[model samples]
Target: MKPLLLLDVDGVLNPMGRPTIDYRRYRCTIGTEVYTVHLNPRHGRRLLDLALSTGSELVWATTWEHHANEWIAPRIGLPALPVITMGPGRPRSEHGEMFKTPHVAAYAGRRPFVWFDDQVWAEDEEYLRVSQGLRDFLLVHVDPRHGLTREHLGMAHEWLTLTGFSQGP
Candidate 1:
C-alpha cells in the first residue's frame, strides 16, 4: 500500500498570514457559517501531482474535518478524501506534543506517512522519533503566511524519493 499523505487545510492550503488582498479569496458557506479562505489554484495542481508521483493516499488531517470536502476541496481541485477522525474534543497529548501528533501517528500505524501542517513542533518530532520509533515519516511544517509552496513540495518530494517511498515517473 502507498504511504499516507496527511493534509491540513488552514495553514497548508488556505495560507493564514498573507494579506487578504494578495490572494484569490473566496467566501464559502458551510452550514450556517460563512468562511473566507485564500487559495492558489497552482497549489491544487502541485499537490495532486505530488500525490500521484509518490503514489500516496491523501487524507485530511485538519480540524476542518468533513467540512474540507464541503468547502475547500473543489475550490482547490482535489477530490473528496478520507478524513482523519480526531474524535470529539481535542486530542490529548501526554508529552506536550501537538494535539494532532499522537492521533496522526496512531492512524498511520506502521505505514509510512508525511504530514503537512503549520503547527508541527519539535516536541512532535521527538514524539515521532523517540516514542514511536518511526523512521519513515516526515512532518513538514508549512509556513502559515505562505502556505504550501514549491519549496515545501520539493522537500517532500526529495524525502519521498530518498526514503524509497516515491513512485515518481
Candidate 2:
C-alpha cells in the first residue's frame, strides 16, 4: 500500500497573519467566516512531487473536510485527492489528544503516514504511539505563522528516505 501524506490547510497551507513574499492572498468564505488565506502555488507542485517520488498519496486531513477539495486543491494546483472525513458534528476527542487524532488514526489504519498540522500536540503523539495497528507515522508540527516551508518538505523527504519509503534513491 502507498504511504499517505496528510495535509492541513489553515495552519499548514494557508498561514496565519501576514505572510512574507512569494505568498498570494485570497479571500475565502467558508460557511459565514470570511477568511483571508495566504497560499503559495509552488507548494502544490512540491507536495505532488514528493508524493510521486515517495510513492505516497496526498490526502486532506484538515477541518476544511470536503471544502478543501473545492477551495484548496485548485489554488494549490493539486488534483482532487482523497479526504479523511471527521464525520457529522465533528466530535472532539474524549482522550487528551487533538480532536482530529482519532479520526486520522481510523482513516490511516495500518498504513504509514506523514501528517502536517499546526495543532499536533504531545498528547496526540502519545495517543498514536500506543494505538494498535499503527507503525511508521510521522507527525510534523508546522508553525502557524510561517506555514509550510522548504525545510519542512526537506524533512519529509529525509524521513521518507530514512524510512525506506522512497520509490528510489
Candidate 3:
C-alpha cells in the first residue's frame, strides 16, 4: 500500500512567521472569524510532485481542517485533499505529546505514513515509536520561519526512495 502524507498548513505551507515577501497574502473567513494568511505558491507544486513521486496520498492534518481545502489549497495550486478531523475536546498524550499525535496515528492505522508539521516534539516521536508500531513512518518538522523549502522536499524524497515507496528514475 502507498504511504499517507499528512500535511499541516500554518507552519508547513503558510509559514506565517516568515516575511510576507515570500508569499501571497489572502484573506479568508472561517466560521465567524476573518483571518489573513500568507502562502507560498511554489509549495503546492513541490508537495504535488512529492506525492506523485512517492505514490502517497496527500492529506490535510492542520487545525484549519476543511478550511485548508477551501482557502489554502486553491492558492497553492493543490486540489482538495482529505482533512483529518479534530473531534470535540482536543486529544492529548500522557507525555506532553502533540494533541494531534493520537489522531494522526489513528488515521494512519497500520499504514505507513509521513507527517509534516512545525510543532512536532520529541514526545510525539517517542509516542509513535513506542505505541504506533509503525515500521515505515516519517515525522518531519518544518521550520515555521521558513516553511517548506527545497531542502526539506529533498529530504522527503530521499526518505521515500529509501523506504522503497519511490522508484527514482
Residue 27's C-alpha lDDT in candidate 2? 85
lDDT of each: 0.85, 0.87, 0.85
Clashes of 2: 0
Sort by TM-score, top down from the best: 3, 2, 1
Higher-TM-score candidate of 1 and 3 = 3
Off by over 4 Å in 1: 19-22
TM-score of 2: 0.93
60 in model 3: Cα distance from truth in Å? 0.4
lDDT of 3 by residue, 1-169 (tens): 7788899988888775755676998899988999888888888998999889888889999899998999999999999999989778896567778999888888988877788999998888888888777567788999998787888778878898887876434
Error (Å) of candidate 3 at residue 115 is: 0.9
Q: Please provide TM-scores, in order, for all candidate models, with all chains considered together.
A: 0.92, 0.93, 0.93
lDDT of 2 by residue, 66-148 (tens): 98988888998999989999877756666588889999999998888889999998888888888644678888999999999
lDDT-sorted candidate list, best first = 2, 1, 3
Tens-place lDDT per residue, model 1, 41-124, is 676778889999988888999988998888788888889989987788886787889888888888888888889999998899
Task: Identify the runs in model 3 with alpha carbons over 4 angstroms from their true place.
Answer: 167-169
